[model samples]
Target: MRVTTTHQLYTARLPNGGAAVMDVRSGRGQWQHLNSTAALLWNQVIEGADLSKAANRLTATLAAQGAEEAVVRADLAALVSHLRALGLLAASPAPAPDPAPMHVREVLPAHTRLSLPDRAAGLLALATALFLLRCTPIRAAIAAARLVARLPLRPAAPERADQLFAAVRRVRSAWPGRAACLEESLACSFAAALRGRAVTWVIGARTAPAGAHAWNETHGNQVIGQDPEDRIWPYAPALRVRHGRNK
Candidate 1:
């Protein structure tokens, strides 16, 4: 079976140009480090290179770069064994069922409904916020707000979180300006904060097309605002905003 990444973990590039794997599902925040060579192998596997292909590519890349071939082979083997042991790389992928249509309210909790206020006033407010964020230096705009968000703020209930996110998305759809992924994520998180909820904001990038995307997640590590996973699932976490701090 070919090794592949599991969706249960988050992958990020460390400052030293290696990969850091964190299993947020455990809620413990433990991290495993991978050196540059291993990180490249991680990326290759995520790109669907099987065991042999990944190894050959790793060897070839190192040899071309004038690294010792024997050392490269040993390191590659060790990295593979370590990844398998950690369960980050799997032998086979689990079948992913098709996602439901986006606008189907049934997919969300049945109890939560968008109220008249949410559909109108809340929507307007969200649109305005998105517009302002788009026009301003968003990071600077978020500076003051993030201070309050980091103070162990209370979380919005699931129903409310869903409603706020829906409002942001609804407004974004009608926006005449360019509301990119970062803009949308910022607007959603800001709107949620105004309603007294603090969510984790994430910005990530993938190398294939070499682009970035943004989204939000709850403090409990549940994804909030939607992201197009197909384009982003292989992305390494780049910047993260949480508890009023950007990391």
Candidate 2:
């Protein structure tokens, strides 16, 4: 089987110039540390290097140490097998494509306030999302959002998307515990889905800081709830949950 690196992988640059990757799908939130050689190999594979070619190149680098080609190849193969078992490699469909260039930066929507009832509902939705995140796997929490969107309710307008996001963001602000971008975005999606708004939940990774982020967007690619000052331009979209039939 032809397996590619998982889209959920996020790189984190170490102070010592090394890098580590995290597979968010693992649900364990542990980083797989990589030395310089391993990091180079990973980047090469991500950029389309096959195992044979990668092993050959790496082995050549270790020629001074008299590393045998056969041994290096065997080690590389074992590493790949282990990574596949860790959900960091798969023979699966391609992930979400990069967003449209023109719309990418300007897609973020203007925020608006929701009614008191709606705000309360948003908080309830956030609580449910938090509980799911803590008790179930990440995939399960996302699946729950997908299920909620399938309910028989009127589709929410674009304006409602903005209001719901505002409500969710407000609710999160008052919580004593801090929520990561992943959780916050999921909560917003959960609240919107309950109100019949099918939004896109996106998770992306960027290199400089070597981190991952999550956010919500609408059919038109209009982003919701993220601050205009916080630039997501550096991120490459890794996964997307497209819920609505609309564009």
Could you list the CA RMSD of all candidates, in the order they appear? 13.5, 7.2
Q: Which stretches of candidate 2 lie over 4 Å from their true place?
A: 1-25, 28-99, 102-112, 152-157, 244-247
Error of 2 at 209 (Å): 1.8
Tens-place lDDT per residue, model 1, 1-247, is: 2222234445566434566555433432345666777878876675577878889988998899999999999988887788888777753322211111112111134344666655564465456556556555443434434554566567766557667777677766777767766666666667776666776566554453444556666645556655443434444554455664433
Candidate closest to the true structure, highest TM-score: 2
Instruction: Output the TM-score of candidate 1.
Output: 0.51
Among all windows of 10 consecutive residues in model 1, the one with the lowest summed lDDT is 97-106
- Over the stretch 1-247, how does candidate 2's per-residue lDDT look in tens digits? 2222334554544434444565557473445665665666666666567866886787787665787777777777777777678766553223235444313422224355468866876798789878888877675665565565455545455667668777777788788997767777787777876666666776655555566677777756766666757764545455566663211
Query: CA lDDT of each candidate?
Result: 0.58, 0.63
Candidate 1 lDDT for residue 185: 66
Predicted structure 1: lDDT = 0.58
Measured by TM-score, how close is model 2 to the native structure? 0.63
In model 1, residue pairs whose N, Cα or C atoms come closer than 3 Å (at least 3 residues apart or on different chains), thus clashing, are 150-243
- Residue 210 CA error for candidate 1 (Å)? 2.4
